[model samples]
Target: MAPNPGRLDVGAALSYGFDKFKANAGPWLGITAIVWAVGVAVFIFTFASTLTAAIAAADRGESAAVATTSGVFIVVTAFGTFVSYFVNAAFVRGALDETGGPEKPAFGRFFQLTNVPQIAVLALIWTVLTVVLSFIPFLGTLLTIVFGFLLSFSLTFLLDRNEQAVTAIKSSFDLTVKNFGPLVLLLLALAAINIVGGLLCGLGLLVTIPVSVVAINYAYRVLTGAPVSPAR
Candidate 1:
């Protein structure tokens, strides 16, 4: 049974992320490089298109330019969310594989697809929620943080537990609430890690990002009493 306020050794969780990530560094780094490269390319393409549209609209009026840019921003945000899910699927599965067994992670697993319908529905719902949340400007950031925390484990639940999309979301919230304190600290630590990674001219992300994913999976497993193999 999970402890009240479920204990999660945040340090150990981070350690597990690093350790497991190290165990499968080749695939972890390679897949991350690919995903990073693709994401940057997509961002650059979308940004250039948006800028061109805004520049063209400027001839009409300032409001027209602002409106055009805003519309393009919305589309880019939604598209980015949808595409990020596929990248997430790869890392989530890789993290799970590394923690769940003794075998070395397969590089091909990074390209394998799983839980497609759930990911699609999940991405759509998340996009809608993000748009709706954006309307509550005063509290949007706080609410987003809370929701992000509560739903952090949803993907793991979907991939590792074979949960339905909605069920996975709800289950994650429920589990997270039971373990809120530890997980909150865990989240903060992850943010700090990534912040440092970013400060290192973004080169550090190749390591921190994979480590963070592994840490989150470790937290999920420990909070739920699932098995976790040490980094071997």
Candidate 2:
């Protein structure tokens, strides 16, 4: 096994991510482009549709119309979130596969349809739980963050191990709680990377998104004492 298999090396994780991402920029960039396009399109469409409905309701002085518009907004948002996660599961798979590097990242590998059902269910569960709970007043925000942080590895677990959605979530929570301190630092570092990436006209996300996903997956393997293929 690689030396100190269970040791949390945030720097090493980040480094491996950069190396692999650089080596496989094509697929990563392609994946990012589609996801980015869909996200922007969805945001604009949702905003315009909901805003028009809201304004029309206001002009007509119809409280029922306003409520219906609000409900439509929530549903659209939830659906968008579900689609995002569903697409993101492929990235999770690509990132994790790139970890054990006997093979280079193949564009076709990212679209492997064998795992579709599991990832779809996983995304559905995550979207529903996160969106619904987040609408709560005080406890909502706290619980959402808590769940988000703890279940950060949920998708990774599902992809790497064929874990069911609920089991994956629970396992991720258990694992994260085990090495809380190191993961906290790793999580902060990931946030910083993405934040900086976001500042660059959001174009930086094309680079940062794959790197962060791979880095976090690397960290997961490390924390779980799983073997990582030697970094190329």
Candidate 3:
């Protein structure tokens, strides 16, 4: 498919995403379920004992033990979140195919787990750089937000555009600057949707998460001029 020359429309993209979610709820939810199940299992396996000890140490006013446990937790959580970026690419691709492609893509597309090493390495680079920049007080906050928005589409671009991880990161920042305002609106809207999902005892995520993926991929398609069918 050829890319479209027009820009993204935030509301229209989100509405299209919700529609796709309604149509493909089962498969999307299945993907979410599997991801969460594995995440929870890994968390338990890695941190269950440390977490218990941390809690006990906190009750005993043991600052050293608490700090150690907290630091370990942060590292583990960062690694998990890094891996999730790759997992999220699968969801983005599936959502793109569902909303705009002529035929359905495989439901387990996210689990294909290709390019994992590249994904992880890029993720680590971003994390370390961001963590350092995040320490600069007000300027740090501003830079983080700007880079956050700039790099937001990196994973989707990597998956959909067949770009290398570093190339995708660079492309995301470049394209995002061209359409900064609309993409920021889209990002805020997705964040709001996820906040609502979080409020619904976390079950709303089964719907909102995939919808967010669809919305971002839709923006990626429009901004990059990727060929896609009109959203129903």
Candidate 4:
């Protein structure tokens, strides 16, 4: 089911996302549960001891004590974040496919790591860029937010289009620039939805997260000429 290539329309894409998510709630929720459960466990296992030690050092009046552990924390956190991006890309791929066709998405599909390297490269580039810019005072935060939204679809492009990391990043940048206004609006809307989800004991994310992914992919379909079903 090929999507009609058309100008990106944020409202239509979001509507398609909401409807698609409702149609496939069970599988989406199951996948979200599995991913987040593992994410939480890994976070605790990796950082619990180190974090406690850092706190203890700070209490002992040694402000520099935490610096030693901070390197390890950054590396591990980056690694975990990289992996999560790939996993989420899988979800985006499956959701986009299911929305455009009759077949359901498979649970194992998101684990396919064929594009892991590209995703990692993209993640690494963004992390470095954001961290560097974050040191620049007031403008840093605003730049990060704008660039973050502009390149939001980099991983999805890697997974869905099989583009190289640099290529995917460029594509995402161009797409966002072409549809800058709508993309900003979409980002804000998604942020609000996620905040509401967080307020709902975090369980509401089981719905909002997938819906967000679907909306982004719906926009991807618009830009890439993939077929999108009418919003139900």
Candidate 5:
């Protein structure tokens, strides 16, 4: 039988994601919310502190010092973002595995996975590509959107494959390139949710985060030709 080649069903994807959330809403939401809360608090504190430091440096007429401090803040934030990506991937995978399937990954195992050098290298490469792409004018903006989608999809793939991080990253790029349209729509949906989440002082994120995890899982399954189980 010929497979359906139409647009990927956004409605079906959203429904699947919602069902997955309903199945294990309590534990998954509780844990994720708490972790996100703490993460946000820490991020705000750091951001405020850095801003104050820059202001003080500027007040002292030390523009060079302010620039140096701003640079350091950027680097720290970038590093933190990279690390958080792995942590979120680990959490989503663990939560889904625990609630939706038989195997339960141990808490903090995702952090342990980051200890492998390949993971860091993969993250660095992904980061560099994203930055370089952002430099072009109109095309750069379009590429950024496309690249962002591929990047998210790729990260989920890497997390699921359990291969060396570099290999996983390569696989993600390959899968995304091969399935561009559907993946782009999926990524756009996620980005919309994130923007809404941000607008609501992050409360909307409670809904978006879990939905994203499931969506990424769906994307991964699609790319790998895995069986899609009914939502529990």
Candidate 6:
């Protein structure tokens, strides 16, 4: 629990994640896949509505109206992204807790946890930082990558464990600074899984989501010696 200097053991992390997926692949995948599908549908619906409003404003030759509409669209989009991030974090933490043998998994309860105000604030800060970093040149890309890993680590630590938000964020940052190489690899692996899963018409999401969740959860446990809870 001394911060898993070996956490960068990519093969071990992948294997542990796959093992967890194998154990509860059926139920986890089924639940997560459906949730993801619904999310995609909602996104499409929102986008269509926003686009229609924008076009209507433009047609009216009202520049101010168009600008206001665009602003609203951006705000709505940001809010949706914020909610999605927290919900996903909540689900991953809930799933990890169940698989790590501390609690029984309750999908409904996990979704409900997303309503927590702190999670929204965390998500908003994360989104703003990501957006700002993305606008930078080459250094921006590098910063974004590093920041992303840290953010993921912090979120996992915060949601899955019982640490206060400030403490979790500080600990995650410290761990990332100490193990930058391994943490980078872990982030890359998770990214690859997501890219591939998304490409497979989302069919691969069933496997990828659960596996990635377990892997990150294990990484947190190894790094922090935090007790994993059973499902709530």
Residues 1-232, candidate 1: write the lDDT tens digits. 6433336899999988888887779998898898899899889978997999899899999999999988887788778877887788888888888777668678898666677899788878787777678768769877877787888888889988788889999999999888878888998999999999999999999999999988998888787878788666
Q: What value does the lDDT take at residue 117 in candidate 4?
A: 75
- Give the Å error, residue 72, model 2: 1.1
Model 6 residue pairs with clashes = 102-229, 102-230, 103-230, 103-231, 104-231
TM-score-best of 1 and 4: 1
Better candidate number, 3 or 4, judged by TM-score? 4
lDDT per residue for candidate 2 within 49-79, as digits (tens), equals 8887787777666886779688879888888
Local accuracy by lDDT, each model: 0.84, 0.84, 0.77, 0.76, 0.64, 0.68
**In model 5, which residue pairs have backbone atoms overlapping below 3 Å?**
none
Candidate 2, residue 185: lDDT: 89
Model 5 alpha-carbon miss at residue 25, Å: 0.5
Q: Write the per-residue lDDT of candidate 5 for residues 120-183, one digit (tens) a residue.
A: 6666776666556655778977887766655655555555555666677677678778777887
lDDT of 4 by residue, 64-96 (tens): 656746655666666666666666666877776
For residue 125, model 4's alpha carbon misses the true position, in angstroms, by 2.1
Best by TM-score: 1
For model 6, residues 133-194, the per-residue Cα lDDT tens digits are 65578998899766767766666666656555566678778887877787678878888988
Model 2 regions more than 4 Å off: 1-5, 59-62
Tell me which residue pairs clash in candidate 4.
Answer: 2-227, 3-226, 3-227
Candidate 6 accuracy as lDDT: 0.68
lDDT of 5 at 100: 38
Error of 3 at 179 (Å): 0.6
For candidate 2, the per-residue lDDT at 147 reads 82
